[model samples]
Target: MSTAQATTTHDEIVATVTGIVAQELGVPAESLAPDADLRSVEGADSVKVLRMIAKVEREYDVELEDEQVFAVNSIDGVATVVLDTLAQDAA
Candidate 1:
């Protein structure tokens, strides 16, 4: 992927993941920070978090391994996984 395209993809993945977390947790999108602990959010639980990850995977057409998915504890971590998965898919 071109450098520009990679940047765009990363931004889109971050934005989309932020939106997903906001929607699933009933929090405002603007309140989501890359370092925020998803578990600390109101209405968030393991099941909801898993569902959110599943939605993200489907949205990006990337499958995250169970170990990677379970290890993601922050928005930034999730973004990294998304980017890595996209890069792998492209390769």
Candidate 2:
């Protein structure tokens, strides 16, 4: 598998997720802090959040539970859940 497809470090996941969220929200990735609340961002909505989740799943090749997905409110939260999902798959 390519490096992008393989399991990556938390920092890398955070970076990628930040990019996805930024793209979905039409904001700068650099402007998104790791702990930034996505729902609080301008123009954020459920559809956009779900779209970001879909992109994140495609990027990481891990499926997240709906509960976990809805519980996500920050970039760090998403990265943590992604890491957990990857770990579960590996196990």
Candidate 3:
């Protein structure tokens, strides 16, 4: 994909993932950002984070390896991993 297309796709995925996280964690969507530290969010624990990752994997129909999922510390990282997985599947 071209640079513009890749950026657009990443942004869209970020928005969707952010929405999912907010809904699952009972936080306002506006409170989540691409660089936000998910673990630092109120009421967020390891279990919740894992749950969120599971939900995301289900939503995108992509299985994220546990190591990668655990290593994700921000929304942008998760988005990147999801996009990368999608690209790999498309290939």
Candidate 4:
């Protein structure tokens, strides 16, 4: 991992992702728990979810696999993929 990525904790990723999700999905960040399903949120659709993911990708400078991105349904899941991607990049 890069020096920064190596030091980034799971909770920090979750918090940053939660903020991006809230802003993109028009929901309060407080309402989005780490395990909260993005598809279950009010007004959330596939397009919105994809948009949120895109924003998150930009924030972290990582391009997630479509399979990985779609396989996940929560902020925690997204964070995991990002963490994995970062790990791979560093490797």
Clashes (backbone N, CA, C under 3 Å), per candidate, total 0, 0, 0, 0
Q: Point out the higher-scoring one by lDDT: 1 or 3.
A: 1
lDDT of 3 by residue, 48-90 (tens): 8888898888877789998888788998999999899888866
Model 3 TM-score, 2 decimals: 0.87
Candidate 4 per-residue lDDT over residues 51-91, each given as its tens digit: 99989888777899999998999999999999888888777
The predicted structure with the larger TM-score, 3 or 4, is 4
Provide the lDDT at 36 for model 4. 87
Model 4 residue pairs with clashes: none
Error of 1 at 16 (Å): 0.6
**Please, what are the lDDT tens digits per residue for candidate 1 over residues 1-91?**
4564355466677888999999998899999898788888889999999999999987777789999988888888898898997788777
Best by TM-score: 4
Each model's TM-score, in the order given? 0.87, 0.91, 0.87, 0.92
RMSD of 3: 3.8
**lDDT by candidate, in order shown:** 0.85, 0.89, 0.84, 0.89
Q: After superposition, how far is residue 17 of candidate 4 from its true place, in Å?
A: 0.5
- What's the true lDDT of residue 37 in model 4? 87
10 residues in a row with least lDDT, candidate 2? 1-10
**Residue 11, model 2, lDDT:** 92
Residue pairs clashing in model 3 are none
lDDT of 4 at 28: 94
